[model samples]
Target: MDDHRIFAESLAAALAAEPDVDVSAAGSGPAALRCLERAAGEGRRYDVLLVDADLGGHASGSRPAVPVQDGDEEGLVDGISLVAGVRAAQPAVRIVVLAEKDDARRAALALQAGASGWVAKDCSLSRLLTVIRGVLRDETHLPPALLTGVLRELTAARRHRTESERLVESLTPREREVLRCMVAGLGRKAVAERLFLSPHTVRTHMQNVLGKLGVHSTLAAVALARRAGVGPADLTGDVVERGSQLA
Candidate 1:
């Protein structure tokens, strides 16, 4: 959804022109929510939602938008909250943030709120379509400019390794081994074979890894591990170092 009806409708129309594409538009977050609710009641699910990051401004063909403050989850005036709301209602649905500016902070907030991807307003229509399709395939489409900033922010939040080290300490020896394999780009079956464990055991360890890292995806967990200096080469030594504590 966007605050400007003309932009939203124009974009929706352009998308609708594509074969096998069904597109809709909303002028505000509330309208979008209402639309989602109605669709849910009708047993119709949306494949993806495109929401503008700064939706608190005036909406075209609708009432003045509600003002949303930063970090307000209940307020539907902004994309972050809308993303969270949509995620809460439909865990499997993919949401993409549409931003007029490359504001890293806003992009970070939207992603943290469960947005699967983001698109800059200045991007071409083809690019937006590609992002939507990529998100549908479960690929995160973070802009390179935003991704560098997001990674920096993520790494900067913990200058010292104390917190990350503590999180790593929480993992079992088996889980640490699984994470090490993950950092090396091993699939679950590969990790299982390498670790001499059942595939089911490997899956369980992967779940534990995600839990300890407080991330949803293995890619995210691996990134956190690399940032925390827990690369594959260090995995064996790190496990030994944490052995006494785990015991």
Candidate 2:
């Protein structure tokens, strides 16, 4: 989806002119998600989605046609996040990110979010169409200029994730639980209540976790846990039962 109406419509028209293409356009991330949902409901899913890399976050005038459902992903704060949202909703659809310029960092993130191709918006229509066809055939495409930097960015992320996982692996099971609660933004008292431990015991566990993770502060530990793919403990359910399961 693109916020620029003129570009969206013109590109749609151009693609529609092709003998084997069917094109649709949306001017905002919410509108784009709506289109995907509607198409899925009708049993006619889109084969490819070309998304503006900067939609939702800084669109000049994005007017979603439908009222957003409460707690829907906020029309995607940025295109990278929208790529992830679309991937979650439609796993089979090939996604291509359209950016204003070649950004290796954003392109790497887009690839991680399931985009099969990344291209500059100023690229020729013929080039974009070719990439679309290529992705449909299960080939990934990236601009040549972006190859080196994108690879570097992805490698660095991988290294961080690996190191974070190693540090997290060093914690004891109880320490790990305490760390999970900490990542959820729970205080020592809250963690004690949820985990059914005494507050002093919780404090000891938290300190042990920080020491094991080799972090000086809770915030640094939280960041490391996230890099390790550790998510917060669910706090909404019955805490008594939840704590029992962990036992």
Candidate 3:
């Protein structure tokens, strides 16, 4: 699963040099899926798949190069996105993603999507082979450089989510209604109309929401609200808040 045919095929040739490794290259996400499907149908399943993290770009290749369109299962465009699809085709397959740059964010996504590991595209051949073999033994592998980053990335995301939920929970019932309106892209005046409140009252509620969310703008408020799983105006339920509701 890479768009660069030379890189894909060259890597494939190198891996095939191993006496026990049977490897082939696919230049696009679709092509990879096809290979998996065909192999499964023939009852000759592959044991491993190495994919490029950044696929579907402006790269020339002899193999079929397909752009990562806003297509393919909820806009799956890159090797990280292709992880789930690969698992669907061959549940037993071990996937190791290759990235030109090491990214903890992308690595977290790959792991969550069922990839066994991720590695640098420029990693040494020996390390690459070691990772491939490691996954076969059901070991989750990552380069030492990415271990701390991925751990911190995941931890920070979790902490932020908890804080956001707590902040959203702190809002009064009326304040929650205002925050939901913000998420719907509603202006204070529009929110007033929808909620049957005076514009002055809407402004006050909006200010309170901003203050509670620790943000200075409506866009920031909406972003935090989304992180807290706040739905649109129509989807929000009027809930009663205790102690902090100076309503």
In order, the Cα lDDT scores of the candidates are: 0.67, 0.75, 0.71
C-alpha positional error of residue 98 in candidate 1 after TM-score superposition, expressed in Å: 0.8
Which residue pairs clash in candidate 3?
none
Q: Compare candidates 1 and 2 on TM-score and give the better one.
A: 2
Which sequence of candidate numbers ranks them by lDDT, best first? 2, 3, 1
Tens digits of per-residue lDDT for model 3, 38-146: 6658766666777677653323422321111111111011255567777775577777888878888889878867888888878888898788778777899987888
Q: RMSD, each candidate, Å?
A: 14.1, 5.9, 8.1
TM-score of each: 0.55, 0.82, 0.58
Sort the predicted structures by TM-score, highest score first: 2, 3, 1
> Which is the leading candidate under lDDT?
2
lDDT of 1 by residue, 1-247 (tens): 5337666667777776776576666667777777666666876667677777776433443321122111111112224456776787777767787776787777767776788777777899889778877777789998887888987765665554567777888888768767878988889987766666778877888998898789999888888887666867343333333323432
Q: Which stretches of candidate 1 lie above 4 Å from their native place?
A: 1-3, 57-78, 157-247
Q: Give me the overall lDDT of model 3.
A: 0.71
